[model samples]
Target: KGWGHGIKTTCVTRLDAFVSPEGKMYYHRCSVEEVIGRKLGPDDNLASAKNWARQQVLEGKDWRGKPAKFDPDARLFACLSQGEKEKLVEPGAFHVAVISARRGSGIV
Candidate 1:
């Protein structure tokens, strides 16, 4: 779902020509492992660490750069929109509706 009635997509910028020794590495994902006290496997999804690592790549582009794939501005905007949606809708309404639904019934 979008943030509003007409909002459809949030476009993030990407840098493909970046070059560095650690440009393609996800090293900061190690922080997530450190925080959780374990080493993550290749398939582990470290959402926060992933974003942070991408931001680091952008920064390593010879100057301070922003993470184009996970733009923090867009994140903040989406969060605000989600907060408004939460405020407007009853928190338990969806759960209540689910509990009230008939089980094993086909679409009517």
Candidate 2:
């Protein structure tokens, strides 16, 4: 099910941060590619990404330094809504996914 809008790229800019449950912040310089997936619209791509993240957690893999809730480097918290933050999973093992980059740098 889709709205039938073909995926297209439009130049844009956004400021975002990835945070941990503990309040540590990781800055993310978002790009259209990182925010949107290839061959799929942003909505579809984001859904896929979320599903992938859930799978990673279920696989018993350590997220540390990568992008899992249990990961020491998972910065998803920064973007999470306040209500979502209140429901954070594995609060004990959350950590910021730090990134250092200059302005206008691409994620990939």
Candidate 3:
């Protein structure tokens, strides 16, 4: 069910107010992990994240801050994307996940 998906320590240099599709996914994952207080494993139930987000949204905000469409801050935090073509294509066929990272975020 996967092809070239991975989370390596690749230092992408940029502060262009956006992140790549894959990059969005990474940040989104990080956001979820931050909320849940742990890193997700490959075998974890990803839908659980969605469920938790939905619960949060119903209570107040849509925790799933989709790339470009939402910010990973504020009430409705915008995170990243998964393999869902529907959510993936929400921004556009070729869209970038807008972000507001400080300078040298790419360096680590």
Candidate 4:
């Protein structure tokens, strides 16, 4: 089972894409790994890395008002919207990777 904004108890077997509030596309890394039957190494692109970092900062806020750390395994890519094209391409637009998993659920 999965849980998040507009998502609940959902099953993701493939690389399901999700759009962030800032209009970025995030894909399930596990699903991608499953499809390719292999794990992915870091590509080390500056934009992608910055996007991931920014996302973490935005999503790291917990309900209890504590800073939370983002998951490392949730690989995501930013899909630049028309408005975000330039900003996303430039450096430092706050972001991070988030992955939701439930106890005993293989939905990660």
**Of the candidates shown, which would achieve the greatest TM-score relative to the real structure?**
2
Per-prediction TM-score to the true structure, in the order listed: 0.18, 0.24, 0.23, 0.19
Ranking of all predicted structures according to TM-score, beginning with the best and ending with the worst = 2, 3, 4, 1
Q: What is the per-residue lDDT of model 3 for residues 15-54, given as tens digits with 9 covering 90 to 100?
A: 1122222434434545556655777686655455446545
Global CA lDDT computed for model 2: 0.45
Question: Which digits, one per residue and each the tens of the lDDT, describe model 2 over residues 52-103?
Answer: 5466567754333234444444576676789987876785788886676664
Off by over 4 Å in 2: 1-44, 63-108
* Model 4 lDDT tens row, 21-66: 3434446656545554677576523456456556656777442334
Instruction: Mark the 10 consecutive residues where model 3 has the least summed lDDT.
Output: 14-23
User: For candidate 4, what is the lDDT?
Assistant: 0.47
- Residue-level error in angstroms, candidate 3, position 31: 12
Which should have the higher TM-score, number 2 or number 3?
2
Stretches of candidate 1 exceeding 4 Å from the true structure? 1-27, 46-108
Q: Residue-wise lDDT of candidate 1 within 5-105, one digit each (tens)?
A: 11113425432222123333222445445655778566444454355455556575322343345467666556676667566655466653333355636
Candidate achieving higher TM-score, 3 or 4: 3
Candidate 1 matches the true fold with a TM-score of 0.18
The local distance difference test score of each candidate is 0.42, 0.45, 0.44, 0.47
